[model samples]
Every structure is written in structure tokens, then in C-alpha cells.
Target: MIRRMIRLYGTWSAEYGLIRTHVLIFCSILEKSHKSLIGLTHRVSMDPSARIYSRFNLHLYDIVVLVVSNAWAWRCSTTSTLLPFFHKNLGESAHLDVGVGTGYYPAKSVHPFSKTGNVTLVDLNEATLSTATSRLRHAGYKGTIDEVQHNVFQPLPESLRGRFDSVSLFYLLHCLPGRMEDKGPKVLANLADALRPDGVLYGATILGRGPGVSHNWFGRRLMGLYNKKGIFGNADDTLDELKRALEGCFEEVEVKLVGVVALFEARRPKMK
Candidate 1:
């Protein structure tokens, strides 16, 4: 898979002028052998004190991990395609993006809301927040942007509660500290509190239980190793548990499993 990814990026480098350098750098890094990459990932994942995102510098994260592995190679189908489709519903609605890493989704998704509405980006990492804010501005987003260097594991400020028309938690929950059974419900409830009446909650997450790894031997092995190392907190975060968590907070909920990722569109009911 690593060889294939290297070859794939090499092909992309030859074709695209803009990202050619970044792609070549990605290929060079991967050439160091897949095992080394996995070992590095394992070390990062296992460190409870050092979150993976906070541990890596901006260049390694933005250029290599975010650009090459996530955007170019496409790890999560929900983030790559489905989430963007749902995000189009944000037409002129105030949106809050929790864990807005590198502003990938906001940059890729058309933000009709930016002209009339505002955007609040929240993340634990200051560098990530700055990078995302800068990336969005560079991508031509002319909206009132607010950056909050706050951890999602804690409650949001009272001023932000029940303020947004939409709240996005793209690829956030699994990366958080603690068990998903306890953390997942709490996170959803906190985000739900930030939504205005009839507001929409939409995003994607990596699921530990899914068809992608079940059928592939190598994929299953990799996931097992990741889960054991605390890289993924979703080992027990099954489809049923996720549905129940959403249903507990929102009046309406829809969830679909795309490969090893879960795509969801949930809504808070309007108050009487």
C-alpha cells in the first residue's frame, strides 16, 4: 500500500504543477519504508500526554499528513466526499467547526455562508488554529472568523452556547482523550447545546467497527494495532452506540457507514 501510494503521488506530481513539490516530498518520506512510518505513528498514538496532532510541527502535519495522506490519498471517504455534500446546506448559516485542522473541509467545501454569516473555528492546538485560519483566508473566504483555542473535551463558553446554526465535528471524537462511551455522548451533548433551535449537526468520524477492516487482513491488523495503542478511542464506538448517542441529543438523526468511517447528519428540534 505504501509503494502504491508513493507511485500514485509520483503520478500526481508529474501531472499537477501546483502541488508537485509537496507530492514529491510525500513520496520521498514514504520511501523510508512503510514499517518506519507505522512505528512513528504507533509512538505518537501511544503517547497519552502528547496528542498526535499537537506533537507534529505544522510543515510535517499540513504538507505531509493533511495534504498528502488525507487530501490526496483519501483515507476517510466521509471527509473526502460525503461531509462536503452535507456542508452545502450551510447556505448563509453561522457555522462552528470543532477540531478544524488545517481548514481542509472549509477550503474544499463552497461556503455560501461566508458572505452573509460567520464562522467559528475551535481547536486545542494554537498552531493548527492559526494554520486553518490562514488557510481559509488564503482560499478566499471573506467571513467574520473567530478562532478559539479551547479543548472540545470541556464545555464551550456560555456566550457561544446556542449561538450557531450549524456545528461540525469532523474527525474529532476519536482523537480526544478518554473512552468514547463516556466522551462521545458528552461531546455530542456539548455541541448540541451550541446549536440554535432547529440547527443542524453534520460531520464524519472514523469507526472502529466497520466493513473496511473486517474484509482486509492487513487493514484489520493495522486497526488492531492502532486501537491497542490508544490511537483510536472508538474500538467500542459501534454503529448502534453512535446512533443511540445522537438520538439521545437530537430529535432526528441519520448515520451511514462508509468503509471504516461514519457519516452523519443530525438535527436539534426547534424549541416551542
Candidate 2:
């Protein structure tokens, strides 16, 4: 349906990216509404965060999220801060990326993915899976790309155990359900199971507030709305708890705050 719409209207529109973004966002809302009518409870439908990316177009994400939100709202410079952080830690061997957003890192990274390695993308949202896969391929990632439709809350299957040399959790923690103290560690433990003992787990997450967090007016406004809409569950999240969570599962943990986002790395998953 989306492909057909893109072909029908995209071919004719000068603002093709804008049109696709609007269409996809609207379609996702419609899809959510249709599901609610079918069987999803009212409570389930309220938090559209989980199913929100089902129709997201990568270009739209780049413009709005990477450009606008990261600058005016989050105040984190993607090119200088985020991209460098990602490049510094990205795995050259078997890699796992959880909560893969439109596959932006791979699509825009200066650090190339290993053509001889494997990249396993894990996400509950199929739209993200598809989009990320497309982005990786577009970026000339010659390695094997694997998509696993799975929740971060659950343990990865045995086949995935100790498989990856690196795992990324970019912008994933805050969007998860429940408070960060509970959700954060549980999710970390689940991912730890997927990594080899020497593997590194690194990624960034937007924090609600903490010692290092500073939210400007725009950031505050967006945070409030996102939390209220159930798009974010990090209203009460703190950096201390996140550090504690990472330290619990990994022998080495490092966390730095850039704007309202926390960039983190944990190595040597203490496998149980």
C-alpha cells in the first residue's frame, strides 16, 4: 500500500520527501486505529511508540529527527557528537543493533560496516527492520544483514547467544515501557546474553533529567508531550540509575552526557 502510494504520488511531487513523511505518519495512525477496532485494547493503543515506526520513511526521519530535533530540541550535534561516538565504537565483526531506527547510522556513517562480517538488526517493528535493511544496503554494506523481529524485554533465542562482538542501543531506552530503573537493566541483561564476553555494548539515549542533563525550552516541551502521549516513558529517568544498570551487567561502563542525551558504553558482559 505504501509502495503504491509512493509510486503514484512521489513520481509527481516536487516535495516527494515531505509527501512520503506525511503519508507514512498518517498511515501508521490509521493502522493503529484499525488494530484497536479489531482487538487491541484502548490502553494498548494509547502508547503508539511500539508500533509507531511501521510506516516511517527514512528521509522524513533524517530531516525531522536528525536535523531539527537533534539541534533545536535535543541540542546534540549529530555530525560532530553522535556520529563520532557511533563510529568510534561500531563493531567490525558480528554486530547487533537493537531498536534500529530507520537505520540512520549505517546510512550516514563514515565508518563503514565490515563487508566480511554480519549485522543482525533486532526490532519489534517490522517497518524499522525493512527501512534499516534498505539503508544498510544503500550504504553499500556488503556484509550479511539479518533482521530479527523481537522485543528488547525478552531474552534473545539460544541461537543468538554469545554471537555478536558489538551491540548498539541507540535511542532505545527512553522509548521503552515502564520506568527506566526497571526497564533499563532488564533490557540490558537481555542484550548481554547476545554478546560475546569481549563484546562491547554502546549507544545513546535521551534522558528525562539528571546531573549532566540540560533541557532547553524546546527540549522540555517535547519531553512533556512525548511522555504524556506515551511515546516516551523516561519522564522520571535519571543518569545514576542507568549507570547502575550498565555496571551491573558489564565489567566496564562509561557514560557521558551530551545535551539531554546520554552516550554510554559497557564492555565485557558478565554472562551468567
- lDDT of candidates 1 onward, in order: 0.65, 0.79
Candidate number of the best TM-score: 2
**On residues 94-161, what C-alpha lDDT tens digit does candidate 2 reach at each position?**
88889887888866652467543888889887778998999888888877889998888888988888
- For residues 158-260, write the lDDT of model 1, one tens digit per residue: 9788888888887787566565667877788878878888678877776666344232333344445446555456666666777777887788999876555
Clashing pairs in 1: none
Q: Which ten residues in a row have the lowest lDDT in candidate 2?
A: 37-46
Candidate 1 minimal-lDDT segment of 10 residues: 45-54
After best superposition, candidate 1 residue 227: deviation in angstroms?
Answer: 3.3
> Which ranges in model 2 have alpha carbons more than 4 Å from their true place?
1-47, 56-59
Alpha-carbon shift of residue 56 in model 2 (angstroms): 4.1
